[model samples]
Target: MSHRQYAVTHTDIEKLNARLLSISLSRDERDWQSVFHTHHFTELFFVVSGEGNFLFREKLYHIKTGDLVIIPPYMEHTEQSIPDTPLEYYVIGVDGISFQPAGEQTCVQVFCNVSNKALVEEIFSQMLYEMRNPAYGSDKICQDLLEILILRIIRSQHVIPVPIASTYMTKECARIKEYLDSNYSEPITLDTLTDLTHMNKYYMAHSFAKYTGKSPIQYLNDRRMQAACTLLRDTDHSISAISASVGFSSQSYFTQAFRKKYGMTPIRYRQSQAGDDAANGS
Candidate 1:
């Protein structure tokens, strides 16, 4: 379903909370920091114009057109427009993150090294395209591509220390979040996370919960539901098919979970979107 079609009960449009999606135009002469706030979603800012620095997690990082700044869940961050140009970008907040253990670990790093700016540009370009000519599943595909770009940011960044936590585990946490983001389709257990972090399972889970507010399993399930919602709205796929696709083992269980979180059955939600689309003459 189109993200706009979701019956969002609590969307923070200034920084789209929960389901990572936003687009904004910037005035050419404005610059400042946003009111600092924590979100329950991960954010991606793809600058469309101007230059700036994002103050995130007590570290200042530079930004510009085509640059991406990722603010993970519960991380306090904001934008600072550069001297000459005002900052603008298509911003999106996805529901969860995954960690990839193999990459050069970075904690709150900005990605300026572009071996492939063209690829990053193309991803944002496609976002513009989808917004203009939305097809079946286009929103879902755009969000997936956004996920890829954020993953690239996590993998290709250089580490900079933030004051919230001591130890290299901060970097380790970033890697684990990236890993979880990439591997969300698979089963994630304490053993899986422990092996990835090279720490004790109980200790690692506690630390993750301490920093990220949700246990690893809770994070994964939330991501799965985010994916499931997109699928149910976009594809003709059955509820059972989507449940399995997002790693839920049972249709009934998925339905129960979906209703609890979104306040409607999957089928009913899809039908509602269909009704709205028809009413809008789309």
Candidate 2:
């Protein structure tokens, strides 16, 4: 028998300092709604099946099976499914690490039709199983699996993982942003936000605006409007129904806001979108 020994070097296997925050499998059924949100940690979104669109940076990116999207911290994003073709996917949240592609300053990256689809699916499946059925050392197992996942992603996708530094202000802003994103439909005011963040209203507003460029109320309204646009484009819901669904109690007020944002009434905006789709044979 012939044997060859290979010497290992420290640079060959650098230590990864990332930690797993959370993981969940998601399925979007009919009329499912997704809100634009941000996280203080890096998020890896792996599409398992069905077709959908990923909304990021004010643009829509078509995502389907085998698509992997890496969202860096503090980036606003959301995902929506097609009418009948609902989206099923896994979201893996990892703290202390972010991805950066070579020669790019932006941290966001999307890899379509990944080469190792089967392996990626297996990793996620095993992680989900472990999460659902925990035992001794399961948490440690999950963390190790997360490291493998990150390493595989980096190797296969040719991206670099950078460590993230969390600050008090950044964490606070992220918390408030996440709260607003998940609960935008609820009635909220300055007092509500103050209570949530436990900071003076003016200071909280200033800090949030400094990070997000929009005041708390403005951000809430914009988030509502974004959801409204999605509903108008994808669903046949009535203006009144859509308005109420997205937090506006008054159809007239919703219409006015929509017009101001889009330079057209809600109905007209829908018609224009339809016209555009037909013209493009979508």
Candidate 3:
């Protein structure tokens, strides 16, 4: 999906007259399929658990926990559980306002990979709690919470950099991330990022770890490992070739890192993905 940006503010959120329609939570214990359903109101569904095939209109998307989907009104969608792995999720319906973010009314990204599942779950659980027991101002509170939910969706749809103690540090860390993103398959070292940023190696490492939460080498390795996963799943390359292609010095080291991160060898991961494809008949 193409990326779009929106400038949001507290006042903008307050001005929105968004309304809540319903809140429903489901925990599927058996493999099942839902009949195609459509609504006149928009639905924001968050997958709290399980991995399955999510059908929107007629197209299917393989989805799992921590994946969030936003479906607007009149969009027919359904879902089917994978055997031995049913889904548990929350569906929040809303009306009275569209998802008009602050800046331009650009197209909203439908799918977001949420990193903080606990925060999402807590907010939804609180919404459900308020829905189940109405107080004197529960309707208003829930309505505001629904708006917060919409704002959360908007927040997830974009890649906003979190501010650090120093703005310069944030930019430098971002520069390191961009460099690694573009050069994962190339030889990279702490000195490389230091030279590019013109900062001391110690300072560079400290700033990057402080802001990005990963040391310089660890971040670089992460990018390489991600690329290795794609190659392992999609290509028929030998392990040694794949290792070299991803900048790993040796196949044994690559295997160890892959197994440490994924709890399985690259070959096992490939075979498992192939098995899944076969079972899904995709």
Candidate 4:
């Protein structure tokens, strides 16, 4: 979460990075042991047939047959199967590809996705065909298939900021989103965001609203609420502590914001969620 990290604004179609991504249709059983790890590259897992709960950071993401989960770079996560059925799945390790910007300078981007089952099947079929044929044009076909896979994932998910119609627009908006996500604990202002993107405050506000479906302040508040939701569901922190952690200047303001968003106070929401989890034996 560096402030000055390069943003991914465009997709690389030609010269896509190739790697030996392996898939497994069977595996042995295991216990409720922790398997926490992080990787520099992105990883994707599709459960073709299985049932499990994936521990993503502090939240539990329930996964099952045909479910896909994309683990972003440096995500600390693990999965545990809850059913006795043998696990079967597709796992892809993304490789970074080099791309030249409009200035002719090169940068690398690691391709990854949150989840898209249709695209996964299409790409898997194409890859299997290429592997079986190994004809003269198989390499090119595989490359195109990989591009399709990346595009499908990008189109279907909202986590990563993919290029829109314009590259500059994407870059500017990505800078704003990245700043909000990385520095949600700090107070931000229109002047600060405008300075970061080098755009006029008025124009930046309007354009951001048009593209992202939210004004800059609204987006920041929504991000804060997202963090609050995670804390309420996973942590033993008090309501005031969670509010402070998510950058709300005062407890009253945080309570009002949480009530407005979730139709309940933070303490009530946390209690309800905890009761549900307990009832489910989680």
Candidate 3 is scored at a TM of 0.49
**What tens-digit string does per-residue lDDT give for candidate 4 at 189-276?**
8998998999999999987775445799988898899899889999999988998999999999999998998899999998999999
Identify the runs in model 3 with alpha carbons over 4 angstroms from their true place: 1-14, 31-33, 100-109, 159-282
lDDT of 4 at 38: 54
Q: How close is candidate 1 to the true structure, as a TM-score?
A: 0.46
Model 2 CA deviation exceeding 4 Å by range: 1-12, 166-278
Q: Evaluated with lDDT, which candidate comes out highest?
A: 2
Model with the higher lDDT, candidate 2 or 4: 2
User: Which window of 10 residues has the lowest lDDT sum in candidate 3?
Assistant: 159-168
Model 4 stretches astray by more than 4 angstroms: 1-47, 52-63, 67-123, 128-135, 143-169
- Model 4 worst lDDT run, 10 consecutive residues: 98-107
Q: Which lDDT tens digits does candidate 3 get at residues 251-272? A: 9999999999989998999899
Q: What is the C-alpha lDDT profile of model 2 across 1-282, one tens digit per residue?
A: 999999976656777789888999999976555876777778889999999899884678999998989888788889999878888999999888787787655466556458989899889888999999999989999999998988888888788777675221366677888888889888889899888878899999988886566899899999999888889999999999999999997999999988998799999989999999999999
* Per-candidate local distance difference test: 0.66, 0.84, 0.74, 0.67
Quote each prediction's TM-score: 0.46, 0.62, 0.49, 0.56
